[model samples]
Target: MFCRDSESFALFLFSTDPRLIQTATQSGVGGVVVDWESIGKAERQVGFDTQINHDTVEDLARVRAATRARVLCRLNAFGPTTQAEIEAAIDNGADELLLPMVRSANEVETVLAWVNGRCDLGILIETEAAVERSGELARLPISRVYVGLHDLAIERKTANPFQAIADGTVERLRAAFEVPFGFAGLTLPDRGFPIPCRLLMAEMARLRCDFTFLRRSFHRDTFNLDLRYAIARIRRAMREAFARSTAELEVEHRRLLEAIATADGYFRARCEMNRTDAVQAASQ
Candidate 1:
């Protein structure tokens, strides 16, 4: 999973439906990253200082009962209540917590301190400063680094948001990928292809990323057949990559087998000499 090191399908849950977790479980999905704001009510105010009011505990209980999948929380990025929100998530048995819109290593440290070893961390690198310090972020207790494509594209200059996505440092990383996953941010269905979801996914697998979140392109876009097709495309690419690795391993195995056979004759000769020595000792 993205935030988890274990092997299993990672599903991001934003739905209030208790049955969604069950559906994911039935489909062999292994982990979920629940956005706290999704389950919460919007703030009464209009600006940045928004309050989220919802039955988080009730939702969590239902989620817990549904499956043994690793659970993570994507909490509010800013405001007075951010810490409290994170604490609530930790208390609810979330295995990891994603702090979005992080712009500095110091901020990450602050989050780590607040988390107080309660749960693992995942940082969303969205700003210029964040992109620069990505290597440092990767080295932290952070389980994964999710590049917020939307924010990064906007903050960093490009002809357009999609163009920024296409021609960006994120793409560069995708091409020569590494460990620690990156998310394809805000690429909705209306955006269409040619923006490189396939390439992004390919890089993820090449870099050994465990999973990435797929944001809904359209409202009411449940993980239906269209989503299945998208998943299948990425999966097929990964399978082909795995097959190539397997072939290489087989070749190496053959070489090892030949080497073992070559060493066998020498080993038998040494055994014969040892037997002669034993016979001499017996006669003596």
Candidate 2:
């Protein structure tokens, strides 16, 4: 249901707009992530710029009626109100529940108690604690593990979040879990930042990544193009990447690793320079 096979696909839709869900579903994405995690007042107080969507149930039902794409509801952090939220999502027709900022396997156990195998379970490996305890977490009954690059970068204060993929964090998780594992965020085919799009795709294919989300960049860049066409283009590129001989794939992976190191260095230097500039301005 979550595309555990070789082909990976997903699109993130923050709003409950019917037209948007219809477009994403018809565009060939296998599933849609309905983000309800950002709406909580507690999350907002922490300075997260999460859009509030009040019509999660309505939107999920609409998407289910409109297309065959699986609907995943990402709930806010586990807490006193988690059971209510989890029940609501399940009743509203969500095929899966994704928990964010999880730090321990005990958290997963608690959630599974509520879930009881009604729907698949997923967790975002965004914090250092999650990364460190990944081995223990992987032993649980999770449908998949997605590496949250944006949040992880903020948590680790890394210049480049992609550096984790290059530095073996992802590899370690992959080894720890038999279920599908995914890292990296996807934009439009031509809009890769800090790394080239092709290189990123190659690395995902090499890692045997099961899925990724089409986020802000995809929506912005594909404004003029047909959504199906854009999705097809990326799928095609990844197919081509995986089609290469093992030797060729290895050579390309090495090249991409080198590129990652270079990008990390650039980001670190730029961040340091900006800090220096800020200090100078403050003094003057």
Q: Return the top candidate by TM-score.
A: 2
RMSD of each: 24.0, 4.5
Give one digit per residue, the lDDT tens place, for model 2 in 1-284.
Answer: 22332355444444455676777667666677777775443432222222344546666677666656688888877888789988988988889999988888899999999999999999989888999998899789898888877567767777676778788888777677777677776766577766777787777777667777776666777889887788778777777876776688778788878888888777777667766765687699
What global local distance difference test value does model 1 have? 0.54
Worst ten in a row by lDDT for model 1: 41-50
TM for every model, in the order presented, reads 0.63, 0.83
- Which lDDT values do the candidates have, in the order given? 0.54, 0.74
What is the number of residue pairs that collide in model 2? Answer: 0
Model 2: residue 140 alpha-carbon error in angstroms? 0.9
